[model samples]
Target: MIRKKLNLFLVSLWSVWMLQSCGNPPLVDSTDLVIYGGTSAAITAAVQAKKMGKSVIIVSPDKHLGGLTSGGLGWSDTGKKEVIGGLSREFYQRVYDKYQQENAWKWEAKSDFGNKGQGTPALDGEFKTMWIFEPHVAEEVYEEWIAELGIEVLRDEWLDRETGVTVENGKITAIRTLSGKEFKGKMFMDATYEGDLMAAAGVSYHVGREANSVYSEEWNGVQTGVYHHRHHFQVLDQPIDPYWIPGDPSSGLLPRISAEHPGIKGEGDDKVQAYCFRMCMSNHPDNRIPFPRPANYDSTQYELLVRIFDAGWDEWFDKFDLIPNRKTDTNNHGPFSSDNIGMNYDYPEASYERRKEIIQEHRDYQSGLLYFVQNDPRIPEKTQIAFKEWGLAKDEFVDNDHWPHQIYVREARRMIGTYVMTENELLQKWPTPQSVGMGSYTIDSHNIQRYVDENGHVQNEGDIGVPLPGPYEIAYGSLIPKKEECSNLVVPVAVSASHIAFGSIRMEPVFMILGQSATTAAMMALDQGIAVQDLSYTSLRERLLADGQVLTMEDRIIAK
Candidate 1:
């Protein structure tokens, strides 16, 4: 009996130990550089660090890497192709190489694709680059880079902001994820759209538009009457009613229409610009997947859309821009489309679970939108037939039922670093110093609020699209935090910029360029045993120029 009791105790102790071991997360290997977020910038940073002979790992919150680039934004929002160089240009060149193969055009012939793009030729032989491509192709390029460089990426690991981050003497020594794994590194980079790691490290950031006066800017705040693009209320010929019942004051406002008052123009607010999923769809019969009506679909939610049709504005197929292989990078065009405005005001700071709910809501909204445009009897027959020809691409996003995994987070938490980029710098009115990269895109902001105007008509506010004079240099200081906050951290995607300035700087190619620059700076800082902010600009500029980064428009020879 004594022997049996002893054996039972031993078994119990072993079981308890096994359980404890399973519950504890494995210790992540310490490295020279740790990058958070699985964005394209993250991939670029990892590759750059690896090339610089620094041990690096990408701690990604997403299972899939390449945030928007792989998430159905195939139609690149390129401004000036000449300004894109370095690894950013290399990525596009790889896409060109992929397309050069005949098998890449599975749904359509390569010759039928024709040459089409924004600022440059779709196929540039001199540069050997293609600006437009499919989502899967972009993802494949990122994966190829990872495979070639042997860069390690930890997928599906989220940072535990509450207690997971361990800061020592104003520097992040280690960061723990919600999965219990801890990554220790000498230098860190936050390349997420939400700026989660930057916030977790106690770095200061702003969530919404700052007042124009705050930055001595022109296009920063609640722009109500000042309209620059066709995305505003100007698109409507006749005033559309906001209530469920037309011209009835007793009825409540329609879904997705806010009843709150729009603030004064040029004033600051905590409201962020709208976000939507840049859907990848195809017209090819074999590659098309019929739009499945979401289980949570409610036709009543689209009451405003029906009212818009009655108003006689039928430009539905305007933004269904064709990419390659009969697929299109469909985006929001007019007043009522894919943009789920006024509903995502809380998403920037929401919890993970709340963010999931918001994402699901957006997915449902867009899915139902596709279905409604194709099947609804109220829609014009001509428009319905046009929309019916397009469906979700079967070969794209197969892992998640053909829908894009990421939503276009147009604007999110922006860091307030050592230097805040403002409109004066973007417009070239003020000389930008410590140049790192260049941004040439226009200052484009989606609608922030859709509310009832003073004249009792529904109007959208905060859609500002102003063209820039030329490409302006992005300062390296904007990527680093105040020395007292964090000495060894760099933020590329969520750089320090005012809302107007970020609108111009927040393009995907720009993010990739900045990511490479940030990695170079991090490697230099590590070698010199100094903080990122204290790194010498002369050495950094020389290295960047040697690496083929276009720091000024004068360096670019635009083919007339």
Candidate 2:
């Protein structure tokens, strides 16, 4: 009997060990707030929660911090800098402070790096803020900020989208990650660009652009003929035929050109905007890593690009926006640049495995494009020669082979919260209530699809860039889900907004601003023992103003 009992006990112990080995860890202590994502918004929200004396934990799916900010998008898209206040402005101030040191300029001198930006100077000494910086510098700032605040971050902890969230009476009580680590919190903030937590919590959200009629907005849906930016094929000297053999329909379409009919101008479609990695390239020989040819690279994939070049489009380096130390935040520029048009339509709702596949495909495409630009014989000799001077920055995203760790999601699952911000609200045709933050960037959307036009010429569609008259207030209701859905959760990055409105609001600085505001509201709600949705906006506004958040155009004028 004793021997049998011993055998059973040993078997039970082995089972327990196996479970632990498979990543089923114990439940963590509940905190006041559980902030998910490793983006700039997550960092800002964590910092704000800490400042408010609330116990917070950042459960990050990413190994690195500061999503796109630390990811290659060093050149910021701040439309009006005066409106970027609170932790958002402070982040830029920290970057400026970092650059002040002589050692900060390693590859180049600060004097040699001009202060040019979108409109204002990149390094604003008077404002004590730097709008542009290197990827490593941004990551360093986030890491130091987190360390300074002693914020606990559980890295590589992905939330289990299925059977993970424990909701009771329409409030998320705790969330379990795939590793079986359970995190309980009184309040939760989904700061991810993808809105993973918000979706998993059963919150109502939108994936693609709504029709113009849905929101009564002029720039919300499939914009087939509208060409706002220089990203359309119309910029080419002449029309490029979509067929593999110039004008022969039987020869089949060239790679990357869709065979489907381009949708109606104002109609809605279930398609999202293109996504790309904002490549950080370096001209400096010492800090440059030559672009590696992706294993699955097919030179044929860029046949359309060759045609674009053939059509006399040569502005390849137009968006190699320079940053510190001779590096650049190279973004998608012309018709056939880095933005992988129409490839990421399903990424917003894709599973982790599928998302990885999509991300890898994008990596391969972008990497191959770089390799093709420098080495392909079809590329213009002069263009190839010029492109060869630049390579991936060796110092950034070291773990990810000098490539950016985060893909610019641009737009994903925007939650359908208490108030849905539309173009009407952004253009001041409709009033935005309970302002928590502000954004002034132009309403921008990258190409959603590339198809053959009526003339049988290849063309890109859905790249809209409508300029804003001025900075507009962001509604506080845009951050919270409908009270009946999930009361404890607040979304900062994927706040509720129409597709066009999101274009203006998706900037990193605005995300940080919203993040701080969301956290402040969360803390206030916790103090009052109320659901986040029930938090009084009047009190929230007072706290936000006190915390230096610019929520209105009036506030911007006063600050200026």
Candidate 3:
């Protein structure tokens, strides 16, 4: 009896220990660097740090690895492929290598898919790089790369924004997550879309558009009348009424149409650019999942889309960009497409719970729009038939109920670092100093708000797409915070830039490039026992060049 009682007690103790161990895992030790994001930039930064033999950890808020890159944005927005060098270029080359295998093309044959992209071949034979890919493929690359490097990634670990960061004497010592797990590090990088780490560290940043006067930028602030893209009411055959009752002033405004007067054209506002899921959709019947009606499906939410269809607009599939395996990287197209305008203005600074609500609202809005188009009797029969052909890619984002795991956060809290990149730098009006990387994509910002115009017609504002003259160098100072604000931190994803400038700089390849550059600076600073802001640009430039990073257009030309 005594022996049995002792055995039982031992078993119970072991069980309790196991439970405790599972509940509270062993804490991660202090590392050389701690990256707070699951973005492509974060992955690249980790890879660079590991390459340079630094202990690093990626505390990701996301369950998945890549932010938008693996989150359905398969059709890459690579501006100048030549300028994309280093690990960023290596990533595309790996994609190319992946396609060489017969197993990579599961849904479609490699030979059948045409080689075309935005002014470049989707499959570039000369460069041995593949620009377009599938979501799962990108995720696979990131995962395999991380695993190969043996880099540590802690997923679903959100930083405690309010009181997480422990900063002393202008440098962060550690950051605690919501789960109460503390991460200590000598250096830190905020590669998040929201710049959560940067914000928590008391770094200076901007939320929305800056006035043209503030930065002497031509394309900054509230652009009310400017409609560069087809995402405006100007595309409609006739002016649509904003009111629920056609022309009645007393009648309340229609759903999704804002009644607020859009501010002056050049004036600044707190509104940020819209966000949506870059859905990876498939038309292949065998691999497609029918669009599921959202839990909060409201038919009235898409009344404007009905009006748009009635106005002879039928280009619903305009942005269903093709990728490998008969999939599409579908983006916001028409006036009432996937871009949830004005709904995500508060996402940058919202609490974790509030952000979840916003993300769900956007998911519902986009999902309802999809279901509404295919099932609604009000939609054109032919259009409904066309829309019914495409559905969510069943194999992609399988963990998230066939929906994308990430929302395309187009713009968010941009760090105001040592040097703020403005439109002047982008347009070559003023020279950008300390070239760490380069961005050649056109300056692009999606619609901010849908409001009643001066003519009393419903229209979209803040959608600007100004073409850049050519490839321009990104300043290294943009990555480091002001020395007084924080000494050990670097922000690559949300680098210091004006709203108009961020429009051009905010691209995946650019993010990856900046990530590598930022990590190099951080690692180099660690070696010299200096702050990232104090690191010599000449030394940084030499290392970057040696690593195959194209810092200038002239370098690109020379490489060619």
Candidate 4:
């Protein structure tokens, strides 16, 4: 009996030691910080915590890091490079440093890349600028950030959002993932574009577009007269069938287009910005994957596309935006782009199975569209040949059958926090407090939904692209959920923006910038032993300046 007791005691002690070395199991009752949603912001937060001498781990459903940064937006959309300081700026600088070597471009010398830098500060052969890139290169930068931080990342571990979130005494005590593991943390950060974790935490949020009257803003919801890209009337000259019941008796609905009438020109509605996958494709013969016909291919859904081709819309072949490594950060274009506008209405609040189905539908739509454009007999010969010249990127997304892992959810679940950034704020009307960073991209929203125009023809709405007068401030308050709702959580990417305001903040570089600022907030809260909302803004602002974040473009510059 004595020997048996000794063995049991030894086993228990060994287990305890192992737990400390690796990490306490889920709900193991410990963790300095737990970040929800594995995004560019989450990674930045983990880095900041680790730097401040705290143990941190990321719980995410995605297997990859750097949400959209590494997703497919390689070419960053940096409106003003000088204003992009802090972690957001660091991401691009790192890309520049990586390519400074002769070995960076491989067979091509600096001469072959060209001189006109795409939207960003990148130099073809010229000097670096801000904006745009290939997906793989961005992924490499994110992977490097992970390596340098030594973060404990648990990928594909979903938040049991419904019952998995456990809060005690006004604090989130633990979170359970789909893998049946629980995570305990003193503080949490919601870095996802969808604001999923914040919603689960009972943080107040808003979905869909708001009325121009409510926020007293110009651009919101089904905007009519604005046409930036050729996505509207340039080609959709006639009426398309309304998806209602056939022949009479209220056929009542179309397949993808919504039945409800889209609201007035400047008024707001429940419609959300469209979503799609940011495809990563390559032209390199060795790495290129051939585009194949989708299993659920449907020809009728693309009748408009067929008509576009017939109308000499032969620009389809040249639509792809190429990135480094011969890969493309493929995006939506023309009248029928990748966005399945009305198709994803239920995604933000849908079950995992339902979400998966939506994702598959988008995949089929995009893939089948590509296949149809290249293979369908209805397409003009030049357009087909041009498309055939390109193929599915063979070398990219090697893990998931070369398909991009993420779907571009432009906007969803915006937190109705203490401070809601309205369109007036983006236009520099409100005096934001303790500003942490600045953004310059115009207020841009994609097609909110398909609707009939005043001219009685079918069309898409909410594609507003208005430029900002100048660089403006993004407040620290925007990052925190209301103090009354949840004290220890911070939301960076899905900061308190009115739906229209988010159009500008939705860029990758801007997201990275916010990620760094949020981490700074998290660290300050930890060091002071207070809720994230209660952290002293004076100190927070100072620290942000020291860390190189551009708070304001005040004639005299300030740094954190």
**Global lDDT of each candidate:** 0.89, 0.92, 0.92, 0.75
Residue range 1-560, candidate 1, lDDT tens digits: 99999999999989877877988654446689999999999988998898888999999999888999999888787888888888898899999999999899888888898678877778787788988889999999999999999988889999997887788999999999998788899999999999999998999999899998998998999998977877766787888888878788689898888888899889999988889999999999888999998898888888888988888887888888788999998999888889999878888888999999999999999999988888889998888888888899999999999999899998889999999999999888989998898989998898889999887878888888888888889999999999999999999999999988999899999999999999999999999999998999999999988888888877663566
Worst 10-residue lDDT window, candidate 3: 551-560
Model 2, range 1-560, lDDT digits (tens) per residue? 99999999999999988988997774457799999899999999999999999899999999999999999988999999989999999999999999999999999988999888877799987788899999999999999999999999999999999988899999999999998888999999999999999999999999998999999999988888899999998897788888988889999998888899878888888899999999999999999988898888899999998988887888999999999999999999999999999899999999999999999999999999999999999889999999999999988888989999999999999999999999888888878999999999998999999999998888999999988878898999999999999988999999999898999999999999999999999999999989888888889999999999988877772324
| Pairs with steric clashes in candidate 1 | none
List the candidates' TM-scores in order.
0.95, 0.95, 0.95, 0.90
Residue pairs clashing in model 3 are: none
Query: Candidate 4, after superposition: displacement of residue 227 in Å?
Result: 2.6
lDDT string, candidate 3, 212-292, tens digits: 999888899999879899999889889988888888868888888888888888989999999999999999989999999
Query: TM-score of model 3 relative to the true fold?
Result: 0.95
| Candidate 2 Cα outliers beyond 4 Å, as residue runs | 1-29, 557-560
lDDT of 4: 0.75
Q: Candidate 4: where are CA atoms >4 Å away?
A: 1-29, 106-110, 115-118, 124-131, 234-255, 317-319, 555-560
For model 2, give the 10-residue run with minimal summed lDDT. Answer: 551-560
Between candidates 1 and 4, which one is better according to lDDT? 1
Model 1: runs farther than 4 Å from truth? 1-29, 557-560
TM-score of model 4 (CA atoms)? 0.90
| Residue 161 CA displacement from its true place in model 3, Å | 0.9
